[model samples]
Target: MYACIAQWIPPLERPRFIAVVLYAIGLGTAVALPMCGMVIDAAGWPAAFYVTGICSLLWCVLWFSIIYSTPAQHPRISREELQYIENAVRSSGTSHNGPTRVPWKSMATSLPFWAITVTEMCNSYGITIIRAQLPTFMKNIFGLSIKMVIT
Candidate 1:
């Protein structure tokens, strides 16, 4: 997504837009993580997932409605801007060609790919463990109230 935005948004505007995206991601997760714990405490785990699921679906709809595949195809894009983008891509050899098929086995065998995948998986597990266990840990370890745990 950052790459996609960087491709079209002007260089001067790119940082601001990237900052906005990062802020949205950070804010959304920050809000949702605590809210999920609160919902779980008040309602139950099932209700928490139900609410999160609904929010996720709504986000998907908004994403599809707002994002365009290419600048030229964007409803708000001007012709001159589109021409400039095409020319820029052509000049930089960044233009796309028709898709090519790749074998998954080749990718699977790549050492760097596997290393990155393992690191990403570990990082994801760390995040998941922190989010899933923090509230319970606080309550049990520190005798915190549900409100404090959630917050």
Candidate 2:
């Protein structure tokens, strides 16, 4: 999605748009997790899953309804804007005929790929562990209630 934004947007504005999108995602995560945790505390873990599943479904609906694959395919894009995207793409010498084939075997076997993947896995695991265990830690260590821990 961010890649789509970066591609359709003007070059000077691309980074800003991508950054805003990333920040929005980060902000949504920050807000949603604690609320989900609270829901778990009140209604048990299954409620959290239900909430997440419903939200995911809604996002799917919105994505399919609103998003187009490219500026050329978008129904509502201005002619000038589409021309601009076409010109930029032409200048970049990158085809919009669909992405070039990726070197999957080479990429999968690459040292840098493995290093980055492992690092990301560890980081995600650490964050998951903290999210799962922190409320208990707060309750036990500081005698905090669920509300206090979540808020």
Candidate 3:
């Protein structure tokens, strides 16, 4: 939502708007973490679920109230702005709704796919080795408490 609005602004102005959006997302997470812990500590885990459910419902209400399917339907959209948006969409060749199929069988037979698959397999093997022995290594090396080991 913010990014779409930011696109209409001047190039220099767009970056500032994007930065603000990113900052707000980061700030929201920062605020949420400690508040979530406090709620969990005070009321128990179920209270956190209740809070999340309420927040989700409120977001749905706000989304339907403030947003429209297209610029043409948005009450705040100006005539010139709507024309600009409609033309931009038409020119971009991105507003189509159509089905497409991926030729995965052909891709699997290709050299590039084989190369990628080999690299990914090597990476997965390394991860598998770590996963297989990590808990035993942690238990022996760190000598963690029994509860910590279980969790």
Best by lDDT: 2
**Order of quality (TM-score):** 2, 1, 3
| Model 2: per-residue Cα lDDT over 54-151, one tens digit each | 98999999999888878888998899989988787667654356567889999998999999999999988987897668768877999987777587
Candidate 3 lDDT over residue span 103-143, tens digit each: 98999789999999999999879866765565467658998
Clashes of each: 0, 0, 0
Q: What TM-score goes with each of the models?
A: 0.70, 0.72, 0.48
Among these predictions, the greatest TM-score belongs to: 2
Query: Which ranges in model 2 have alpha carbons more than 4 Å from their true place?
Result: 2-6, 104-118
TM-score of 2: 0.72
Stretches of candidate 3 off by over 4 Å are 1-27, 97-151
Error of 2 at 118 (Å): 4.2
The candidate, 1 or 2, that scores higher on TM-score is 2
Q: lDDT of all predictions, in order shown?
A: 0.79, 0.80, 0.67
lDDT of 3 at 76: 95
